[model samples]
Target: MSTIPTATRRRVLEALGVGTAALAGCASAPGAKEQATEAETTPQEPAMNAAQQTDVDRIAADPTAIPDPIDRSEPKTVSVEMTTKEQVAEIEPGVTYTYMTFGDQIPGPMIRVRRGDTVELTITNEEGNSMPHNIDLHAVRGPGGGAEASMVTPGQTKTFRFKATYPGAFIYHCAVPNLDMHISSGMFGMILVEPKEGLPEVDHEFYFGQHELYTTGDTGEKGHHDFDMEAMAAEEPTYVLMNGEKYAITPDRHGSPSMSVGDTARVYFVTGGPNLDSSFHPIGSVWDEVWQQGSIAGPPNKYVQTTPVKPGSCAIATLHAEVPGPIKLVDHALSRVARKGTMAIINREGAANPDVFEPEA
Candidate 1:
């Protein structure tokens, strides 16, 4: 029942433009929606042996595996306990926020593992007072790949444990160096790992994405009521949400959003990238199967329709709202749709009286 009280669904595409196609209004979904067409052809899914995608792309570029990349390993304490102040909780439903998150919502959970199994995490950095945080996983195995075992110093509390043999879909950012202002004021998450016989369990799953913040206002609207740090060290993130506000993910809160008509909803796209670059469409429901790159083992690539998740990717389509009212949930990038990205409003069936879409303009 984890509403993720801590947030973890990056995409905030357009960074400051509305999202989900302004509330699509379903109907299509019987078929037809493929488009990646292979992007090129030769690389039509079969080109990643470059020494294991370059030794896991240098273990996803230093998430701290540092065996001897020049010697480094001294962060094994794992105490963490400063996380509190929790409030904002709707991806879509009235949309109330307080921002300056860590446990309230903004890109925060989902760190499952298995590939090589060896995760031992414990992060607690209470609000900003005890700021200095750490976590660079990227599916570890060696050399600055675990970010020298998660660095922390904001009230102190650090720990490190590694081994995850890089299965796929890795990411656990927060190298902290103004690292996107602590991953847009929420730090980050997602490290799948699973590969010893896992993944493929779904009756209904949820994990949306998109968040790039830097609000203290400059007309970026309200980033949970601004909180400048010199505009976050000049990061310039002015309200750009999707799973943290403005119709967050709406589906069960009210304004119509529940999913059930036929029941399929998997939607787990991530792309908080270093910036933004998502275009994930679901309008009128399409994607029959699309584990695209979130591939832990790989094989779901059949139906499609507007799929592009750059900026630290992840995907897992599967719709079937079955002719609902407004099943939207965009970032299809379509001109940012409305400013600060978002488009929730799903009501597959009924619950709180379900009248279906139309929470007023």
Candidate 2:
């Protein structure tokens, strides 16, 4: 009943120290799909016009750019401001998508605060936006995940305060009425509520987000893509991407975010899934330590092969780069990798540790 070959499955199970079939796509559920229509696929004017297209193109010209690193220090009242807007973005070369974003980036900015710190959060919907938006943070302990209190109309701003009582990696996303459509267009990010003791130091840390796009055009189709509400409602996405593009975090694309082979990397991962769950896995590497669902309140799960990050949630995983090669990160939904854009590369640089793993020509 396993989709993986027997030999490969054995090796993976051995490496992971578990025999569960969770990583084999046995727990996946169907998602909504866009109903195919001539106008949907070939819209004369995409979500963005010529001028707006030019503006976004300039903003994302550097695809591999990462969010600024956070300073994890003493507990203080951290004032954070987030702006919401929509723009046309490149899904990949020759492919475009309309992304409704936070801070004008696909996965918005990363917010960090200590467990007991007070967060003065501000949400602003730009004047040009056509719809209302609000944030629902998983870390919040109030009504609608704080969604009800922060709803902002176009050109309006809302402010609220919340105390970070627990420690964990949490997801923050739009909770508008048509939630699926809004998220699929890219309105989500991660907020780290660090434990008072803080996390173990790592040589490298990188933050990224994964979300699905339900486009009118098929995967890899040329030209501008339109958002399909029908597909989003059904939870069927045409592209499942990391950092908003086809491997946008890799050296071959944006020429940044590479790790030295000897360095231990901490990955802050969040899924903006209005529907699908992510079976987070890194091919050719084991999770030496992982904070399941980003919960720092408990002990970490060691030697984990894959962990599911549900929609509107987050997880923290650490990988030791012992070998020199591309540590391929994926959702473990093989079809999504084979078809949709759900892949990232952590290029390792160092001497080969043949004892750990080696190849023969």
Candidate 3:
């Protein structure tokens, strides 16, 4: 197989009538150094037989897995290890994307620790992978947020220590150079550094990370497609999705969980945008309590309609489900939902509150 030079790749993509702004937003053109790194880290193992494999449906992590609020009287050392692997998963019906992930799951797995706890973090890039990867944690107050120390090539592992000095839901994502492409390819998740007192308990808690895919083909296009560099550069994603799929969290799709009426839902949301920002809002509901920027240290604001979850950031939003219906989770940009595929649904069970909102004949 031959590698296309960055210039040639851009030209070919442009001639094919790809998005016009595609090349404009690129931080810089890929150079010889990047090419050399790619060559050096190429995988050597036999490729998996695609026909023999099956796509695992979306799986939600149990909220109980997250540690309860910490008792500050005893601050201890916590250890965490995450692995990086390349996977092929469905991003939409009949469409798949190659995702570089932590723990082999899109949006990765959530890392939770208490403020003031010393964290021993490890990142391992599996041998079957073909590139180097690292992590940048917003909760860490250090150089590159541990990115510089955790860069590991395929079959290698690196460890870094960081003190959790802040209390917030921070994003942790791949920070190797050209990370935009890596992140858009699905290498991102959230880390929660809980305040010593912890957050207010809710009836149900859900975790989601929002990100976009720049594909070589249009939205909903069938068949496996290559990464669209031009689309990424232009911030024109073919699909913008939550938890890594179209309608991933809807009751009708893949058995994702739904909230019951009168149940208070606390959503741990992270935006892993390598380029775009997220205006997160739940349709037909208001945020009863919102921790801006996922800040647990500060008091939450009430009645937030929508909160901006910028690139590489997070927010904690709580909604009290009073109505019985499908609560649409969307980015208010609307275009992303109308064209791209940014959406999730929380079905409310139990009796309807027709007094508050009733459909008339």
Q: Tell me model 1's lDDT, rounded to 2 decimals.
A: 0.51
Note the clash tally of each candidate: 59, 7, 0
Q: How does each model score on lDDT?
A: 0.51, 0.79, 0.80
lDDT of 3 by residue, 1-361 (tens): 7766443465578779775576444435668567657767996432221221224544223322344545565678999999988877777666766777888676788888888899999889999899999999988888999999999999999998989987899999999988999998888988988878777778887888889888766677676656888778878788888877776766556545577888998888888898889999989888999998888776899999999999989999998989888778899999998887777777788897788888883
Query: What are the per-residue Cα lDDT tens digits for candidate 2 across 76-122?
Result: 89899999987776887777766888888767788888888989999
lDDT of each residue in 1-361, candidate 1, tens digit only: 4321111112233344535574233224333233223343433322111111110100011111111111212222222222422233322222223333444444555555456555666655554444566666556665556556556565555656666656766656667666675665455555565566655555565666666555433333312343445544554454555555544455333233365666776666566645776677777666787877677475887778778776666776777665545667677765454765455555566333245334453
TM-score: the better of candidates 1 and 2: 2
Cα displacement (angstroms), candidate 3, residue 186, comes to 0.7
Q: Put the candidates in lDDT order, highest first.
A: 3, 2, 1
RMSD of 3: 9.6
Q: Which candidate number maximizes TM-score?
A: 3
lDDT of 3 at 347: 74
Q: Candidates 1 and 2: which is better by lDDT?
A: 2
Worst 10 residues of 2 by lDDT: 45-54
